[model samples]
Target: MAEEALFAGPAIRRLRKREGLTQAAIAARLEISPSYLNLIERNQRPISARVVMRLVEQFDFDPRTLREDEAIGGVEGLVRRFADERFADLGIDREEMQELLSAAPQAAAAFARLYDNAAPASLAADDPFAASRREIERWRNHFADLDVAAEELADEMRLSRGDMGLALVDRLRERHQLSVRILPQEVMPDSLRRLDLHARQVQLSEMLSAASRNFQLALLIAQLEQRDQIDAIAKGARFEDEAARGFFTRHLMGYFAGALIMPYGRFLRACEATGYDLPVLLRRFGVSFEQLAHRLTTLQRVGQRGLPFFMVRVDRAGQFSKTFVGASTARFVNSDVSCPLWHVHRAFERAGELQVQFVSLDVAGEREGGWLTMARTVEGRGEPGETQFVVAIGVEAVLAGELAQARGISLRSDDAQPIGPGCANCHRVRCSQRSLPPRGRKLHFDTIRRGVTPFELASS
Candidate 1:
């Protein structure tokens, strides 16, 4: 490789920053020192092939992503090396250095660097979400490709044709002569695709509760029976690189996993049986509340859906780890998506209460412009104070009317008094709940806004 060969440092560094991590944080993820990390990031050191292998395994980076020709070169990589909190007044804080080194957090420091890197870019944009998105577009692209494939498969499988999942499943059983079994978590994980290779049966685990096990089992059977066909569909995509391709593969796999849990037809029945109530579905399907919420995102199996839905689960920080789009019409902002009035935050407010929400855009959607639909709350399963996830599900403008529960709700996306993504990204102009000024617009610097919403958005 040439001396100037790209080490993918910039790309990797950008990803870490977007996730709000630092070199020391990355080192912690790999159990190394910041000095060692500095050397590697600066290209003063080269990440051993061993470390590269570890990055893929640890962060789920595609091994190919590391093979690019970009130099660990740019000043950012150097910035990452010297970018210690101890020197922050000079853009790196001195006191924070000791903690960063000793405590060795996995991502906090890296996130700081990202702010330094993108802050200027963000300030230039009236819309921080658009800028933030540019920085992490790869992540979205990966999901986009997979989502496209999933949708196509959904269409071909005739998911929208009503009870299509069962019809396809039935056909597979008849043709492949495969048996389907549903076992509880106690008996078996949520599901498995048993493929015997050399007499070694592959046990694919779904980590589902009992009743959910049955629902997912049927889906897995359909996926398995069509495994080759699905693989072909995935391979047919026009991917940019192996790394991007691999991440998408994993995501699609997750979708299939979800489908198995809530096979189209039966799930639609359960949706009717329980009035599309997630809690009721969880109990009926014997799955976690999160699992039930996640499964709902896959309702695009064509004709069997109750209503088009988009599932979002987040914390107060506006960070989203799970996004399921069951309906095309409903869309979510990709960067800095925190909202207080949004059902997700409310879910956290009523942490354990299974409140059947009837929110329209005005009730929980953005409080400004566009059509929006939302449902939110923090749900519990294990013991108290054990890291329960705050969650919310929603439908965007295009499919807003398809909502089964949106009767007499806000008609516009921003009808619900909208909130901003944490103070970091929301552009809502006068939200009393402003956490921080939106990531972009200059702060008034007058009557200290002192709010949770971060933006000076258009509406109020």
Candidate 2:
């Protein structure tokens, strides 16, 4: 088999510009002629193994950049956006979209933002929760500075899973002169937590579990102590409104809370030791399954990175409540709807049991490959009647061999279930599970034949 050529022109050019080094200077350092380097930079010539090594040794370049699909996300996002009926007549192809993203990512992003802003009044532009979700996705759900600070604070506080709640309470009372009070459900009917500044009391609902109480305590600490750091990060995001900024800051505080409970270094080590077992980790961390799954998505510390994981939470009605893409290149992350065939939807039927499925997105060709998804139904935080949610986590199938969850499961494409982002964006015309035809494709209704799907899509 021929070795696949590495066409990393964009990455190389970006690195050169970022380092403020001329092509000729970098060429000289790599022991290559300027003309040859120019050819490599133009993607006419493949970069050699020796040059890759030289780049790593000289500039500490990440080898992953060599295979990075910088435009895949933008192209996929635009593909979905253009799938709308409004842009159906424009007839834009994937190649053109890819070129636009590759040439001017900022412009493409701005255009996407503009389109979002012009959306219907029902999809309010000032929706802070939506803005917070975007902000989380923008940072790939990892806040390095917050993680480091939380870890340091955890070290200083000497928190243990067994007595984490008590420890957090003591820290709050001693450090901030704030008392922790757990009130009955009736007393705080509408509120789970409330901070009375004058009384210096961090009141919590009695309905909250022990784990949730600890998390709330940690979140309060993050808000109070890490206010400056959180505010600085939110300011950098440049949100459109103050509400968005406030929500983003709250999310950062939550990130801090998770980090404090499960320190990155310790969590990563435990995950590796246990082959990324969620049940064991949940028990060890003294956190709910949802909390543990969320924490798994934030283990992206450089040099000590875990597998790039994506997490999503959805109700039985197919409403997505939370989504974090982490560093995965899965296109499904950008879509609002999930494929019905994915394990997440099935998790509702088999509540509490972990449902694992190997799925591949049926995009333009089978280019994105497969993913290993694990889902389980979790009890949502509520009072009288708790809302159940399916919390699902996924990683690229190629990287799932190391996970204990993938044991006895074949990661081969032949065995994997073919899925898509959603019925509207999916190109799987023959899919029986499709609820709606693809957005921009014309439907062919044949009286003579009935296929798996109600209508056959015209092949463009």
Considering every candidate listed, which one attains the maximal TM-score?
2
What is the TM-score of each predicted model, taking all chains together?
0.46, 0.78
lDDT of 2 by residue, 102-183 (tens): 6655567667767755755356556778877778877878899999999999999998888898889999999999998999
Indicate the residue-level lDDT of 3 in model 1: 16
Angstrom error at residue 382, model 2:
3.6
Off-target runs (Cα >4 Å) in candidate 1 are 1-208, 211-224, 269-275, 283-287, 300-306, 326-332, 355-385, 396-415, 447-460
Cα lDDT of model 1 by residue, 1-460, tens digit = 1111223454456557766888888888877788887766654565654464356446635433342211121222233445445545676543554344323322434544465556465454544333333322333223333344444555555553235335445545565554444333454433344554444333434343344434354445435544665566456655545554554455456556455444556677778665565556665545556666666655433223344445666766667765554332233333346556555555566656643343322211223223344444543333334445665665433334334454555454233444444555444445666665543344444356554443444321
lDDT of each: 0.47, 0.79
Worst 10 residues of 1 by lDDT: 68-77
Backbone N/Cα/C clashes per model:
63, 0
Looking at candidate 1, what is the lDDT of residue 441?
Answer: 42
